[model samples]
Each structure stands twice: as C-alpha cells, then as structure tokens.
Target: MTETHAWKAEDFAQVNAPHVKTALTALQLTGDALEQGGAFAEIGCGTGEVARFVAERGFEVWASDASQSMVEATGKLCDGLPVTAEVCPAEQLEFPEGRFGVIHSSWVLHWVTEIDEPLRRMARGLRPGGYIVLQWTGAHPRSEGPGMFGILRDIAGSPKWKDLLAEAQPGSYEYPAEEVAKVLEEAGLELVHYEPDLPHPFSAKKTMADLPEMRERYKLAGFATQAAALGDRGDEFVDEVLTAMIRAGKTDPHHARIVARRPAA
Candidate 1:
C-alpha cells in the first residue's frame, strides 16, 4: 500500500472518465432514497466527477479526499455546483448525527487498512432511513496472473531485477466478503442491495485514456521505487510494463459493491 497513485487535476478527469459509469450505477441504485436521504456526502470524490453528477441531479454534495490536490481538483470541477470539497480520511471524518441522508463512498475503501470502521462510521453518520452506498474494489487473487500486480510481480521477480524489487507488491490487497457483511451487521445497517466480485479488467488499451499521462502511471501505480531502481533503463522498464499490460488485455480485478440503509430508529 505504498504511494501507488499519482493524480493531477487535468489528467484525472479524463483518465478516470470511465469511473463515471460506476458512479451513475451507484446513483441509479440509490433512486428515490436520495430524495429523503438529506445531504449527499461522497467520500473519495477523486476529481469530483461523481460529485458533480450527483450535484447536477440537485442534491447538496460534500466531497472529501485524502489528497489535497484531489480535494482542490474536486472543488474546482464541482464549482458552481452545490458541492463542498474537503481534505479528509474516511475513517477520521466525522459522520455527525442526522447530517447526511445519502452517504456514498465509491471505489475507495480498499485503499484503507480497516474496512470495517469506515463502514461503521458511514452507517453511524446516516440519518435514519437514509441509505449508504459503499463500493470498494481490489481483491486481487494472488494466483490470478497477468493481472496488473501479477505482471509486475513477475517482472520484479525476474532474474534481472529481483534484488531491486525484493519487497515490491504493486497492488496487493484483499477484501473478503465475510468481513464486509460482518461490518454491515455490526453497524446495524439494513441490507438493501449487495453485488460482489464485479470484475474490472485492466486492459491497458482501454484504461489508457491518455497514453502520455498513463506512461507516467507506472510511477503512480506504485512502481516508483522500481522505476527509480531501473536508473538508466527506467524508460525501457516503462515500455516493458506497458507492453505487458497491452498483451494482457484484462487484469481481472475483483470488486465489491454494496447499498445498505440505516433502519429508522
């Protein structure tokens, strides 16, 4: 879980335009619950694409991200739209009583260490009868290969570069289904809708919205150390990685999506 993401305001919007579809799906699932759901708060707003969409639909939106750059980018993108962007961590953000009706955190929780607490906090923050939609991705099975990390792991473990990448795990994280359910139950949230293991393939061809920007992504994707270790061959290493990704059309990513509501007290 090292620094694996490098996002700029200009590039993030385009590179992540694909995420807007998932954002729409979340909103579509929320439906009328959003009307009664009070203020809409989005954690991990990224470049605020989702926040902007939610605001365009007329809900008051407050967006937060761990990166100040991201918060600023969100603030800028969502400007003139009923949105407030801030810098905060999901676990640390206060979900005061009766404040938010729709609490949404998209594609963000897996980056966190303790997935349970954030769910608890989002649940606790919700108004009674308010709905919470939490979508966390990344449960990459180590066995699954040519998956993004698998390719990187193989390259790092290859005889040529093993020493430089002894401890490299580009994108290694797991979010088990049972743990997610336990957190929901613990928080007293009523089960509304749950979709698990939606595969998000990492096809370099499709994912690379801007080839030039994405070329820098290996660094952003937590290959900074290895890239640096490659020294004079760093550019060559980037080419090699990109070639591998292109050859492996799909990274076979696993995602967990959930929509639940706090029972009216």
Candidate 2:
C-alpha cells in the first residue's frame, strides 16, 4: 500500500483539529524542559496542524510527511508562519545532528516498517536536553475486538493488508508504555512523562449519530490505505467495515503519549 495515498489531504484536514489539540497539550506539558524559542520539528505533519500550532507559539518549525498533498497543504496552512514543510518519509528523514530542541510526532511512527532507524535518527537530531514528544494509537478497544479490520481480514483478505497488519499483528500497534520508554532509553533519551492511555478526543456517540458522514470521512482518511490494499474491491470493503463498526458501536482506539529528553551534555 502506498502510504501517501492512504489519506486524502482534504479528508484528513477536516478531523485534524482534535489531534493538534492533543499534541499542543503534550507540548505544554513539556514546559520549561524545552529551550524557549529553540528549533522544533514534527514528523508526519499531516496538513501542518501541529506545525501551525508550534509556529504560532513563536517556534521555528520544520515539518515533513510522506504525502506530497499533505506537505503542500501544510505549506499553505502555514503560509506566513515560521514553518517549513517537506515531502519525506520517516525512514528517509535527514536532519542535522543535534539540531532541534523539540521533536514531535503524532499518530505516525507505526506506519514506518522499521522503527529503530528513524528513532535513532530522531535521537541524533535532538540537541542535548532536547525533548521528543510522540503520540500513536496504542490499542483497539476491547469492546470492538477485531472491529472493522476483522471484517476486512475475513472477507477481502488481501495479502498486502494482511502483511501490513501482520507485521504489527492487528491493524495498529498497542505498544506498552514501559516498552516505549525503554526504546527511548536505548536511544539515549530519558523518559520525562508517559501516558499509556488517553481518552479518545472525539465523541463516539456523535460520530455514530452522524454515521454516514463519518463513514465517508473515514473512507477518505482512515480506510483509504485499507482501500488501496483491497484494490478494485476497496470501496465495497470499506462500506461494509464502516457499517459493521457503526452497528457494533466501536469507539475510537486508545492513544499513547510519551515525552522524553536527551540528556544535557
């Protein structure tokens, strides 16, 4: 599955505010741990929402994403702000060593096939005493066990989707907070704060109430990648999955947040 095409820029832009809000909260929690006015970078900066928030706070922001449309959208959204947007994949990230004091990524790292290299690069990109803030979906709601993807795996059953899910087992990773902290520690970062589970930023009841529109948005944003994995049958597959999710009253997946710091020299 082409990572870039999995999410449409316009569709993602619509539901981006809540995520930006969460990332902003994480940034605020970092507080004085980050050097004031220091360089900041966001990986997978879809639509530039978080970058805009950071730039508006007077930080020089650099953001990158695999999707060109997202990069372009970010550029336009951040126009006139202290921000730069580039088209780059996580594995290809190339930042100067010890260049940034704050690095942020939201709902992005799991997409990368390999986490170690990019993580090592992120660690290297931070200046001593820098802060690295990350957020990603940790696990699916037990209530929705197998949820939408379960239907896909059973019906469509494409090898690509299977492999993608198989790599991490299930569509999304639910890394334990301790494991994530250990990964950071191995990369020479000290854990400052960790939230293993955060409340879903959106309301499931409201989403279910507006099931049709929500399904459309999900088709464009969340299921696009899955659709791409399904090829010609993608649309039908997504429709069925969304219908199932609505019927099952599945809530949004839980998220994990981590704030770690590179030790002072």
Candidate 3:
C-alpha cells in the first residue's frame, strides 16, 4: 500500500542515491550475485538506482515497483542497461519459476503488511542457490531511538503524531531477527545472513532530513493512508517534527538500517 503522487525519477534519485550507495557499500555484495547471471530482480526499484548498479556489475536485472510513475522512470533509467522494468506488486510478479539468481529490495519492505507471501514468491522465483538481499528502514533505521519521530512529536505535539505512531506500530513489518529467520524458513528460504546496522546520519537543515520528509516518503509509499488522511495538518506536523529533529541533531545524531539475506538452494 505504498502511496503514489506523480513521483518523478529525479525526486527518488535525489533522495535515495546517496543513501542507497551507502547501504550497498555496507552490504558488500562483492558482485557475487551479479556473477550468477540468470535473472536478478529488485523489488521496489525506485528510480532503478540499485538495479542499475547491479546491472552495471553484470547481472541481467528485472525490477518492479507498485508506482506506475516509478516503474516508468525506472524503465527510462535502465533504458540501455541489461535490466527490464515492470510496474507490479511483489505478490503479482509473473516470472517463471526459478528464474532469478538474485533478488533485491532496498528501503521498501517496511511498507509491506507482511513479508511472508512476498518472500515465498521470491524464493520460488529464484534458481537453486540464488541469493536474496534486502535493505530497509527499521524502527531504529536512520534514527537513533524513536529517532526522527521523537523530534517530530516533540515539536508538533502529541496530537499530530498519535495517529501515525499507531499506524506505524512496531512489528507491523520488519520482524525481529529470530522472527525473520522463521519467516524465511517457512517461505522455503535458507537464512544466510541477518544483521542490523546503523545508517548514515541525516541533517534536517542540510538535507530536509527530518520527519516531514520521512512522512512524505511513507505517504508516497502508500502505507500511511491513515496518516495521509490527516492532510495539510499532517504536513504541518512533519514540519514541526523536523524543526524539533534539527534541534536534536545539533545535540546528537540518529542512525537506522536493517540488512538481511537468504540463499535459496
């Protein structure tokens, strides 16, 4: 249920390119997945930056997004690369069984209601011994504790965020490591790696690095319909939260990241 609002390629490219690169570097994929060479799929291929990155390293890439504009933009970005782009939900992917050597999704899984079905699909889509890598924002990803949300709530007051906090309730997505291992096992994926890492810090003043940006991303992600329903007031709430976050960053930085992998064999 990711939001869609005529997103342009530039918007995503601007917001994620740096962060994605940082995440990718931290993952240290080492081009092993790319070397497998059957098909590599990236779920939530916003602007196709990560897809293109892997494509350049030699994987024949297949990428999809729920957003039509994002799909179109991703296609344009992968215009000449060895990548194919589609607009579809993870649950509806139409590739033949065992078609991919690698599957990837970056910063998008938090929007999912439950990852079991999609992970099942991904496991089914992989060739024997294929790899799956996912990088996403967790409760603490990109922020310290309650991270940016704490700042936003402080400035905007409790009323504005009460609804969002409820919607963003913990464990709605991104299971704890043990739970993730269980989900993968249930989905027929062998857990090869599961690690949590702190993400690079963001500056509200320098990069609009605050809760409003975070909320807008979630709104576009379509998972925050309840929060979006709050409308302009929701936006104002974000601003207030950002203001508070900026003040806090002046005192301490926030960090957030969740990285994991499954190898199908």
Candidate 4:
C-alpha cells in the first residue's frame, strides 16, 4: 500500500494553490490545451485545484490520488464539474490505452516506487500526439552556506535525530533535466520541452516580519518530510531551520517542468 503523507488535504490545498497555478501558467495550459482535449487526468490531484481548473475550461477530467481523504476532497472541490476523483496511485493507475489527450502531474512523480513503469503507463494512456505535462523538484540547491531544506536535511541526518531518520520514509526522488527527458523518450514519448528551473512568485528574501508566513508555508511545502524525520521535535527543528535560512538569506527551491508528446498514429 502507498503510505499516506502526514498532511491534511485541506491544508495541502491551501498551501499549494499558488504554486499549482504557477505551474499551469508555466506550461501555458490555460488556453487552447483545455479547449482541444479529449480527456484530462491529474495523476496526483491533491484537493483537485488543477483538475477543477481544467474542468472549468470545459475539459473532462479524471483526478486521482493515493489518499482517500485527498480523493474525497477532490470530489468535493470538483463537484458539478465534469470530473471524477479516484483513489489511485501512480504505479496502479487504471486507464485504458490512449484514453487521454492531456495528462498533467505536479510534484507527484517522485513518490512512485519505480519511475519507469508509471511513465510507460502514462505513455500508453495518451492518445496519438497527446501531451503530458509534469512539474517536479529536479534538483535541490546545496551550497557551501546553509539554505532551506539543505539545513533541515543536515539536521535530520545528525546523530541527535538518527533514530527518527531510520524510521522515516525515503525522501522524494529528483533527477537532472537530461535524465528526465531521456526517461520520457525511453517510455515512448517525444520530449517537446524540458526546463530544469521553473520560476514561482515567492520571494526568497527573508525579513523578520515574514517569518510567520514562511513558517506556515514551510509546513505545507513538503516540510512534513523533514518534520517526520524529526519526530515529535519536528516543530522545534523546523523553527531552527527556518531561522537559519533567514539568517543566511536562502531562496526557495527550484522546480522543473517537462512537456512531452506521444507519437501520432
């Protein structure tokens, strides 16, 4: 079974909405892509924000997530729209061959136990010349000085948190842009575009005034992973990490976007 993340669906939706919107805009999916679709699927439709966005554009959407709460939340969010919410994981997605004209995933692929099989399934599920857009953490920034997650990760790896790290689930998988494109091509999709860095509106600039806002955002932005690694002391750990980041003026993490197409029949 896929392990449930330590996040509530509502909390995730509230925290990730802006980032999701930014990703959709970066892919330029707000216009014609929605209008021309046969069917659209969001692989990890947390709270269904992106699904609803596509459905609002008049596209039929199948939104799936491993978490039942998330699926239910998606269903509630997408009510009255042409959308179906299912509790499905990336590895076990059950779509008929060539069922989708467009498939979209945001920050979800790295959770798969094995990447290739899911990519293959997605490739087969796309209709001829269909598009698949994905956004994921390509690489985390690690510099000589302390930064955001890097500091958190270092703290987690320390002897004080050794027991917690041993019990925590593995961290998300990240790959370079070239490797990502190669994987897509090997899965039988033509790589249309691959961007290693996709910009977001969030400012990395740290100010004493923004600390509270940053703390809240961190809680929602996969900091749960680090929190899990710190066990009951997670909050305290994050507080220190954020303080360190602010002191060092660390920026937000970078994300990658890939757009690929299945070959025409």
The candidate that achieves the highest lDDT relative to the unseen native structure = 2
RMSD of each: 4.9, 4.5, 5.8, 3.5
Residues 74-157, candidate 1, lDDT per residue (tens digit)?
A: 888888988989877666788777678798887777667566777777878888878888776655443553355556667767
Query: Candidate 3 — what's its lDDT?
Result: 0.58
Residue by residue across 167-237, what tens digits does model 4's lDDT show?
66445555555666777898788877767776666644667677777777766656765675565777776
lDDT for each candidate structure: 0.68, 0.73, 0.58, 0.72
TM-score of each: 0.74, 0.79, 0.67, 0.81
Poorest lDDT segment (10 consecutive residues) of candidate 3: 251-260
Those runs of model 2 whose alpha carbons end farther than 4 Å from true positions after fitting are 1-3, 33-35, 139-174, 202-213, 227-235, 243-252
Clashing pairs in 1: 4-220, 37-101, 202-251
lDDT of 1: 0.68
Clash count per candidate: 3, 1, 10, 0
Clashing pairs in 2: 138-174
Ranking by TM-score: 4, 2, 1, 3
Residues 1-265, model 2: lDDT tens digits? 2444456688787777787888878887677843387699999899887888778877899999988889889999999999989888887898799999899998886556567678778889999989899887643444445544455445444653455434223243344456666778999998888787767655344444666676666666666666656567666666666666667665455577889999999
Q: What local lDDT score does residue 27 receive in model 1, on the 0 to 100 scale? A: 63
Task: Please list all clashing residue pairs in model 4, or write none if there are none.
Answer: none
